[model samples]
Target: MVATGWRPKAGNRMPSPSRLAGLLRDGRFVVTAELSAANSADPEATWRRAEVLRGSVDAINCTDNTGAHVHISSLAAAHLLVEKGLEPIMQLTVRDRNRLALQADLLGAAALGVRNIVLMSGDDVTAGDHPEARRIYDIDSMQLVEVAAGLRDRGTYLSGRKLEQAPSFFIGAVENPFAPPLEFRPLRLQKKVRAGADFIQTQLVFDVPIFARFMAMVGELGLLDKVFIIPSIGIPRSARGARYMKEKVPGLHVPDSLVDRLEKTAAARQADEGVRIAVELVSAVREIPGVAGVHLIGIKWEEGVVQVAEAAGLLPRPTFSPRASVGGHG
Candidate 1:
């Protein structure tokens, strides 16, 4: 119903695996929904929303300047979530920011006890609708993940200096299940893992069957055990949302049927249609074997995300009391 949930109970083991992907490894679903608001200042509002949703979901997924349309950095927003006591999987955009800034952000996150991160190459700066914006790419997304993983693993900074304490982040990367020739996605995913990626989240997934096939291939790679893979799905609200994603966001494609649905829905029913589509897609996502959970991207539909979660049967949920469960196992 609300964006932020209740403060997580103390000493609950913070959920084992710590990373978004690892959280989903045990066959439990993990949802990484986006709730970052347009304004970057004061994440408390969205962070609170994240807390509320975290109860029903495994992890909260934040985006980094998603599609470069408008919004605060995903890392900033995720830090806000962290401050609010939610486990946030922040997206690291490896486009404009350099390695130094990225490393700093990582340290800041670790200092705040924020674990779990998602690395992305990010959309082109020119794509931001701000033609005057400059793009600074020191490294690609995969390279960024590799660097972060090495630092987190080796207790050293990129400069090769040992740190007082190495960060323990659950590093994640992205993939597009709908990438052309789809055959190449597995190889790309493998490269990321070999480079030290612990888990992965994929691009917008519209077709469950296509995603199932992607999972089957993932199983073949033995990655299911070593790395966690979850797919992303967006809640299309306006014709503008769909249009922007289709025409601007690289590596993201909205199926025609959904577009057609949006086209046909009356203005008054558009919101309901969006919720129904998200619920149906999310419900289907949870059923995918090895799927950690669904990442709901409802940038403007913050409240709508709650409705979708409820409709998807992911809410009215129990607190994730790892201690109680661990004792039960014992």
Candidate 2:
């Protein structure tokens, strides 16, 4: 299938303003993806994965040692992705870094043409390749968001040091609505927003009713007007893939109906059926009030994600045109 994707022209040392911010502020439906992990020495491996998502997503997220697994630095991956002509939502997790490292990297990202950043409290080291690695909790995600906001808005550091030029950042935070204590999820989102989050990307969504209720509470709390909400949906490649998400992934509610549909299909056709279900899920996510967009994450079958985007009529995605200023949601 032909992948129709748009990329910000790469060449100038000067970084452009954030297209992701502009699109969301203009009331446009944004499409983003958590790019498949890349670990090769060169940028080709990452670029190829991004190529599949380009047509469907407006911005691609580079994970930060996801699941505590080690890979190339998220910053390096993001810089390479920028060079490859793709926008990178560079994720900064507090799991491995202290406040000093976080602040420096945040500034470094701005200098390297990365305008979108997401703050996350990542998984423990035991979850990945290095169980003995030390954990740093000098600050949490909310504090990190505050620090980023200070740099973006006031041009000062947590130490009160001043900068000649502040980095323009479109800050983001992640939330898990599918998890139990659902009511507290929106409340935490409110705190994140107050801490200077411009947008919220929810955990993988499978149960629509639960998400709808979460959105309703978000609306009731009057947070709908404060931050953009983008729900994530993983494209399962087969019945087995769907079952894995339900059984293996924590805090996710994958209904039996979805898994059953894919399971009953022939093995050869299950892949195609997976795409169909994903497209339908995207459509369902769009109808809910206060949903700014949908983020599609491809597990191992990145190609299947491309098909879902095309099948859902998500091609010719919103152009990545930089505005003069990265607008603050605050």
**Quick one: RMSD of model 1?**
6.0
**lDDT tens digits by residue: candidate 2, 107-182:** 9999999988999998888878899999998999999999998888888998999988888888899999977788
Runs in model 1 deviating more than 4 A are 1-22, 43-54, 321-330
- For every candidate, C-alpha RMSD to the true structure in Å: 6.0, 5.2
TM-score of decoy 1:
0.84
Candidate 2 lDDT for residue 308: 79
TM-score for each model: 0.84, 0.91
